[model samples]
Target: MTVKQPDLSFTQNPQWIAERETHWGPIEGFLKENNRKEVVEQLKKLFFTGVIDNPEDVREGFAILYYPLQTAEAWDYLFQDVRLNPKCFKEFMNASLMGSYNEKFFLDDEARLRFFDYFHPATYQPVIKSRVPIGREQKIVQIEVDRFEILRDMAAKFSQFLGGSEVPVIYYRLDYFFSFLDEACDVMDVSNNDKDDIQYFANNFLQRYFKIESDLEPKNRGEQKAFLVRFYNHIANNPVHPSIKAIWQKVLDEHD
Candidate 1:
């Protein structure tokens, strides 16, 4: 049987949202009033019977069903049919990463690492690229770095699981690395000697890994600072060579 494609255009449609809420209103009320166990059994039957077809509807149902419950057991129940209902898994991942779901459904470090273990090498490139520049306006390099670090750490811990496949080197830019250092120095009272040491280390590291040289001087301090803040934050959060972390720490230690 040919499955009907989900109507993605309805994502922002007010009419569709109203219809969805209307359709789910009764189920939501039932879940709110009844014991979770009873609701789970009833929903499990409906889920298995293939009553739901639209991805958006399925996403909304999962949210309503799981919102009241806050345990892995509940998540597993919702995920039981994930293989049969792949859209649920996709939407769940999207919701988790986009912060649409509450903390109860958040994918912690271990869960995220395990989740990415199954990804093909081709999938890593776009994932890294899309995540690298998440918070440019915040002007906090460390925060942005921490976000990307999640993916970077996942890549490292699951290297064996990934069969030692590499994300494209193009995604790792040296200028961005220098920009991070530049931003770090701005906030921290880094000595010229320390800055020189960091520059040397970064230069050699880039040469060794990417076989390229980076211009450490900021052409436009404001623009570069913002860019570097996001870039550095990603590096700080993720796994890197021991020297990189050591140098970053050294710079940070001199902060006022």
Candidate 2:
């Protein structure tokens, strides 16, 4: 069954001023800036409401209006080391919110679904609508479930951020991960290796990247195999949208 995408509509919504003020403090001076206000209005219209109608139009609008603000430093830091920080997830959410706000203002269901397809917002939302009540407000399972949700959100957002870029440096970093993994495997093989060493290395790498704690043990061989199968299966279930792939190919070309 297909999942329904959220509608966008944030741009030009006068309510955004109050909404932003709650998080960012007083916005009198901010709202006073004509250019900034216009940008914010545009952001609300296109991002929040799905008014733009097409990803190509969105890309072009971004380039013409927003690209100057997107510095090389921002791109490099974002694609290279910035993704390692979980704090950036909030910014992504903010951007997504802005897009949806705009989309809702200017676009319809079909257009909104297209925008959702472009953004993959579902990957970042909470797993469940409400927690399953256990007893007396302890919520031990709820807390654990929430924590895992955060991790999954981070993983999905990180993948989207990297995958969303049209910058060469970004593609190089992703390609390097695959190459680095292959090279690391070859170098660490001892041939006399109990094979446990290979598992240890892979586990260690994932642990560090995923911020797994010291107490957690690597899954057994069968569990590990199942995980690999499930991860690939998940990828297969959700095909990458073509617009994103085109952006990636453009980045790859610059590298070549």
Compared with the true structure, all predictions reach lDDT values of 0.36, 0.31
> Tens digit of lDDT per residue, candidate 2, span 88-174?
233333333223233222223443333223223233333221121212232212111132222233234333332322112112223
lDDT score, candidate 2, position 233: 47
Residue 125 miss distance in model 2 (angstroms): 22
List TM-score per model, in order: 0.24, 0.19
lDDT of 1 by residue, 73-139 (tens): 3343334422224333444443333233333322244443323332212232323221111121311
* RMSD after CA superposition, every candidate: 17.7, 20.5
TM-score, structure 2 vs. true? 0.19
Candidate 1: C-alpha lDDT: 0.36
Model 2 is weakest, by summed lDDT over 10 consecutive residues, at 127-136
Q: Counting only residues 3 or more apart in sequence or on different chains, how many pairs clash (N, Cα, C under 3 Å) in candidate 1?
A: 5
Candidate 1, pairs of clashing residues = 141-229, 141-233, 142-233, 145-233, 145-234
